[model samples]
Target: MPLTAQQLQAWSRQEAAAAQQVTTATQASIWLTLWAAFTGWYSRPQVSDLAARSVRILQPARQQTGGLGAAYVREVLAGLDAVREKAPAINLPAARLGADLEQVYSRPAEAYRLTYALTEDTAAATTAAQERLFTLVRDDLTVARRDGEMLQMRASGVTHYRRIVHPELSATGVCGLCLAAADRLYSVAELLPIHDRCKCTVAPDSDTADEAVSIDLDQLYEDAGGTDGAALKRVRYQVNEHGELGPVLGVEGQKFQRQGDAPKGDPIARARRELAALEPVLDSLESRAAAGEDVAGPLAYQRDRVAKLRAITA
Candidate 1:
């Protein structure tokens, strides 16, 4: 039987958890293959297959990691389904691009990268997939405005491309560039397309536009402020959990609080609370550093936490 919306959500959560486990296992297998290769115990194909399998397993997880935007899509679709159920006589547009929409909403970024990666050796398929994606976005998705290559949508949102191709793909520019553009227009928390060929343009709706803010990456780094730019870079890398990078910021709130002035009132208390939460992690990293052990991963996690804290404080 077809799953209802609630059932689908439940199933999706379960599937997401299971898929995450598989992805982790696959990552372990790849790491093992790397170790085997380093020890001269396996041929190239063995290690390659392990990595490939890991990518395959991680495909769904990576796609779903778009966070709240994916949830929004699911909710919107569910609402549509409810409407259909309540009023059978109500006419609704046939989902001619259902599969394409699913492909987009299910995992826009990874799907684009995966399709590109898989079909690198098959130019025709690559071209076809790209075309298919473009057509769906251009023809099917309700466009609110179009100015040159930039297209804004009423339903799905903004996309910019040199031209449209297929329902499932596009002939747009680099996916990362598209993502960067989307990130500028939408909140980082929002789902942004990450297809290599996606050049979608977007502007926030009237209600959302006031809240929409563009990120200046350089400005952010500048605002972090430190005498040593290299040190700042290292700190960022460490926070991201790069083993090669040394500890940038401690997990403890003490170091962070000392670096920045505390806000007034309850906000200061909240900041301190966050720092308290992070203290143990920071201490662990410090201990590891003193022992000359790699603490990149922990550092990265702490850095991310600190970044979030800073954002909240800001």
Candidate 2:
């Protein structure tokens, strides 16, 4: 069952879409956390406002169609897991099922860094730092989410993957090195995302597609009302109230989510201002600790948060 290149390409596209869903989920959770942190700081400048700092941005969203309060990122991960089971069940390489996927992911950690930095105690309208952080947030999540997808995609087809950077993206030295090395085949482990905001991708070496057998996923597809040798259900990508991806009508009985024309906008500006507002609390905590008071607990916490912010280097 040799699947055509189109089959692999289609699966790749689906995985990419799912990856973007994860990216968007992280972005939204981060944004919401910043909002809450800012509102708390603005309402009452307190050190406790930093509780939103989860070391990993976690905002669990309830599945609108009905389920546990699974966060947006969790949903994507679950959906992807389902997709993985269904996808490779099609005459994909059997070796993939037992693939070692024990690698831990750090997307959430980087996400925390960006979101935590974006939020501070401030009542100001907007600052250059806030704007810069918001602009880069999506790409940051993109790199992280895609790293996970690359691993998943590699499981089905080929162990070796190649790095692909969109030509439109401005290649930094890191990206340049990846692009130059794009033609070389490497193990999936060797090709994890290099750094935050890294926009590179690892693609299956299609030359090995010849070795990929086409498992019959048509039964699974037909059970879901698909036909004509399709592998995945139509209407798999979606957008729900949380501004994260959802399953469209056919799968989730959800109405088609109208895509918003506007880009990620300025409401986030106020969120960043919240981080700026944290300065007062941080300053107080630092001073009390400096003067040698028992403010150790409070000061340690504030320093941890401020250090996360400073990690942004913007």
Candidate 3:
């Protein structure tokens, strides 16, 4: 069925909103089809460009979103070019459906399953992709830890061990740790691959060792929650008590041990110190939110802190 102009406009707005929410080019392409369907204005050139870019980013298997095969992308591009020359106002439903099908097939019903299988099982397609990428890097990588017992380096240059263990159910912990380290070490735009069973860990260069230090656990913990203290607590409880470690920790029973003996200070005193450091950040965030300033900037800091705090308290 040919979509009315009004319908097409509505779909375009929805697709734009979806695109804004996507964190990856692959995701954007998949969602863009929805926009095309709603708007009925599938500019072939734009769609072709988007498809090519998205295919380059996503895993090859994900390129087939709907039951449509990889050739569907080429077909869409060809159709778009033909329409540009002959039909200014053409039927877009079939093309839109093809694009949507590609998106559906490309997306994993369970993203965690796909990420985990790729990272854990060596034969998996995801693992192959990661290994292929690793072969391209030339940096000398090493494991850095505060205590020898806290982290262990595997015989395989690709794996590391932490004493504090969590299950790999979701990519949250793994992604959080990697992203935090990456943010400090490289620009945000730099691609950092993090996945379950990924062995990659970053440490300061030999010359930077004297200046390198573990991130402030308290500040990192507090910043995780921002103003949502209750939600933070719930997440902490889930990770610590409920055994819902998600994908960050990898497997259950893998623990990240503390490098040093427990601090001499009282527990209450430590809590007070942690809270003191966090209050200012939270206060700043609250003020910004109240003033209608973009709250996301502070919110990320708050969330990181909350994660750190949970690690400490747990």
In order, how many clashes per candidate? Answer: 27, 20, 39
What would you estimate as the lDDT of candidate 2?
A: 0.37
Residue range with the least summed lDDT across 10 consecutive positions in model 2:
61-70
lDDT of 3 by residue, 51-164 (tens): 344345443312122212112212222332332211121111232113343343222212212332223231353333333222211110100111111111111121222111
lDDT by residue (tens digit), candidate 2, 1-314: 44354444344334444544655565556556554334222222331233234213522211110111112222233333343221221121111122221111122223333343334323232233234334344433443344344434544444565444432232222233233333355565543433334444444554433222122221223332333222232323221331222111122354533457453445346445654765677787667667887655444555666565555433
Question: Between 2 and 3, whose TM-score is larger?
Answer: 2
Against the true structure, whose TM-score is highest? Answer: 2
> Candidates' TM-scores?
0.24, 0.36, 0.22
Which prediction has more favorable TM-score, 1 or 3? Answer: 1
| Model 1 C-alpha lDDT per residue in residues 1-314, reported as the tens digit of each score | 33243343333334334333443453444335332233111223443443344344434333333222233333333443342211111122232212333333222223333332223223443344344333333222221111111211223343311111111122221222322232333332232232222223233232222222122222323333422334333321101111211112232233322223565459756876776666565666667678998655445555666667767767
lDDT of each: 0.33, 0.37, 0.30
Candidate 2, RMSD to the unseen true structure = 17.4
